[model samples]
Target chain A: MIEVAGLTKRFGPTLAVSDVSFEVQKGEVLGFLGPNGAGKTTTMRVITGYLSPSEGRVRVAGYDVVEEPLEAKRRTGYLPEAPPVYPDMTVVEYLAFVARIKGVPRREIQTRIEEVSEKCAVTDVTDRQIGKLSKGYRQRVGLAQALIHNPEVLILDEPTAGLDPKQIIETRELIRGLAGQHTIVLSTHILPEVSKTCERVLVINQGKIVASGTPQELTHRLQGYETVLLTAEGPAAEMMERLQRVSGVNLVEPRDAADSRVTFEVHAEKGHDVRAELARAIVESRWKLLELKTSGLSLEDIFLQLTTKDLGEGPDTSDKSSVVGIV
Target chain B: MRNVIAVAGKELRAYFHSPIAYLVMTVYAALLGFFFYSFTATYVVQSFRIQAMGGGMGAPPMSLNEYIIRPLLAGVLTVVILLLVPLITMRLYAEEKRSGTIELLLTSPLTDLEVILGKFLGAMALYAVLVAMTFLYVGYLFLHGNPNAKPLLAQVLGLLLYGAALLALGMWFSTFTKNQIVAGVVAFAVFLLLFVMDWVTAYGSGRASDVISYLSLTKHFDNFAKGVIDLSDVVFYVSVVVLGIFLTARSVDALKGRA
Candidate 1:
């Protein structure tokens, strides 16, 4: 439903998005995962025909955004980072105005407004001034306006940014319900939101695509450098020495020692399991193994690892393994 | 177009919903009313003096339409509009930018011309309301004295065109900045400069003076106040309106290159 090919945007000297290419199939929900200033909004703006790409082309519903902006815009609905709403107008007035400008059938505008207001759960605030509503309600009104015309594609930038926990869950469910009918590209910095909502994720960093896959695939790919925590009854120095001798153990350091019970954090080599080896070694050495904990890299770890690293080293390369670090 | 009408309707509703519209209307009506009463009193006093000198038998009476009403409607009304029209036009685009609503407007399917024309029509409609209130005073004149409808129509037409040209110019300046105060101030400065071009003509007598005098909005409006609907004057105001509209369109188009 949407195709962005080699898209690049430059604001004076800063390259907001650089030679980025991506595609969304019909009825697929693609999560744009990136930190702030990662060019996600810029790419979305280009796809929606709000901003022309400085270099390449963007097509929505088979219409080139630059050449046929009106046709492309007609099929796409965009909610910018900030909800573009007028405070003085009531929710119904704002929605009606949007419906008119978006070319909804004159006779069907009222019904369309009712349907979207219901879907977004903003019906009660339809008569209330938008300026007086809470932030959550205003956001729902923003969503209502976007869906008023029933566009085929929805481009939402950080849709659940400022909502409370309950509103966030409600909005997430609302977006999830919208899948399979409207192709969606939603950008977010919230990690769990993507894991629950999106079918596929594209991790972007420093104006480049660092990784792209299912949430499970991303976690599994970065699971090679999982860390382990061990508690043993022995001298701290002796435990560190013995744990370092285990095969696949890259680094070991004592965390703390109390009553001769020492805690150690063990860093293992990629794709290596040193837990069993260390446990057996401690038992043979007369040291009691009190507690052993091993954990795979979480999505938060993967996100921080992907974005905090500098570009031009290995993250920007197409090789997936090169992007992995001390996750 | 339907899109244009939709935008225009929204903008017009916005004007009435805010306090600025009523404020401008009240202030405008009060000023015009004071000027109308003073001009009529001065005309009535002058007529009495002329009659007392001639013994009041067959002395010719002064024409109120040419002497008082025309200047009040054409000259004073135009200046008042030039000062107040910014309140109507300043928020046309500037408020949208400040409030981040321009994103919604530009991303919609409507074209730039539709948005510009719709806003222009909205501002003109509000100005019409302000101008219509003065008709109450005009009606009072018709009840008491006989006046020529031809010059009256000419004055009304001239003021409409003059006000439109000013509104268009104000819209153009509003397109340049997101700050409404800056837009209003700059619009005022530009209109004042254009209004004073006739004085520049007095300082020189060459081709420069001719161009300055031609560019003076007051010079063209003077012809209309004198009961002459010259084609040249009509063309000048129309050209100004067209120029303002295109400049506004260009300002909006520049956003694409910078976006």
Candidate 2:
């Protein structure tokens, strides 16, 4: 439902977004994963028709944002980083105003207001002035404003930035519930949010799309080798020698030894499951097996690997074995 | 049109919901009321003095339109509006930009003209209310005196147009900055300069003098206060109003590129 091609945005001489391209299919929830100042917000703004791209084009629902802004804007709902709300107006008043501007029929404005207020869980504060509401309520109100028009595409820039933990969970649930009905593009620096909510993740760094794939794919692709953490009551050097003898074992590094238990980080060859062999070797050796678990690279590790790579290197450097070797 | 009204309605509510509207109205009413009292007192005193002279030397009875309503509308109210209009308009775009609400407005399906016109009309509505309060004071004159209604209506029309022009200019200034205080101060300074622009004409003559005198915002009101609705003055104020709106629309458009 949204396509951004060669989208480059510059503020004066500094490029905010550079030659970035991506698409979110209809009803697909796409997550923009990046650290702060990663051009995620800038790209979202260009897509929402708030800021024009300095170089390329953005289309939403088949309408060009620069050429047919009204049509594109009509089908897109945007919640900016700051939750564009007037503090003096009540929730209902603010929603009604949004409904009107978004072109909800005059007769349907009241119902639409109630509908979004219910969906965003802001019904309780409908009559209270927005300025008096808590930050969570205000953020929800911003979401309600974006949903008031029932637009086909929703562009949210850091939809869960400042919420308490409980509120964050509730917001994630709300966004997940919205998945099949609305095409969503939400940006966040929080890694877990992408794994939890998005069907596809676009990892952006330094004004570029550094990586893109499903959450599991990102982890698996970046992790070329398998790592297992094992703790056992054994002689550390002897156990390391014994594990190194097992087939497919690349290296065995001792982590720590305390209370007669030695922990080892075992690295295996790619696509190798050394757990069974290591377990059998430990069981037959007369050493008590205290702990054995496969410690795969989590999304946090993958995100750090993708974003922290040297800026001068190409994005393909992320998939190189040298980088994944550390993970 | 509906989009315009939506934005306009929001702007109007923003004013009423905040203390700014009430504060401006109260202060404006107090100042105009004080001026009305002083003008009435001076009119009464002048009329008595003329009566004591037994209408000697062909000193006709002081006309209420000349001695009271004219100066009150053309002079005192003009200065008062100069002070209060900046307050009404300073937040039109500045506050929106500051609070990030401009994102909502610009990203909506509404055109830049719709948003700009809506804001212009919203400020004009509040200013109209401020001008409307003068009617209560003006209405009292009809009860005890025979002031010409024609001149009163002309002065009111002139005052509204004058305010519309300044409000538009103030709104343009508002679009330049996110700080409301900065917008208000800069707008006030420009309005004051426009009010005194004709002062330079006293030192020069010919076409340059005429042009400066014509550009003086206060100079155009003289004909309206005298019950003459000169088309040139009407066109001048209308042109300024259009110019302000046009410049503001361009500024808002430029925001899309810069922001």
> For residues B1-259, could you state the per-residue lDDT of candidate 1 as single tens digits?
9999999898999999898799899889888999998999998888888787776668557887977788789868888988898888999999999998898999999899999999999999999998888788887888898888788888888888898899999999999899999999999888888898799778789998998899998899988888889999999999999999999999998877685
Predictions: Cα RMSD each: 2.6, 3.1
Which portions of model 1 show Cα errors greater than 4 Å?
A253-262, A311-321, A324-327
Highest-lDDT candidate: 2
Candidate 2's C-alpha runs over 4 A off are A232-247, A251-262, A276-290, A311-327, B56-59
TM-score of chain A in every predicted structure: 0.92, 0.90
RMSD of 1: 2.6
lDDT tens digits by residue: candidate 1, A257-293: 8899999988888778788998998999998999999
Give the clash count for model 2: 0
lDDT of each: 0.88, 0.90
Model 2 residue A101 lDDT score: 90
Could you give candidate 2's per-residue lDDT for residues A43-115 as a string of tens digits?
9989999899999888999999999999999999999999999999988889989999999999999989889
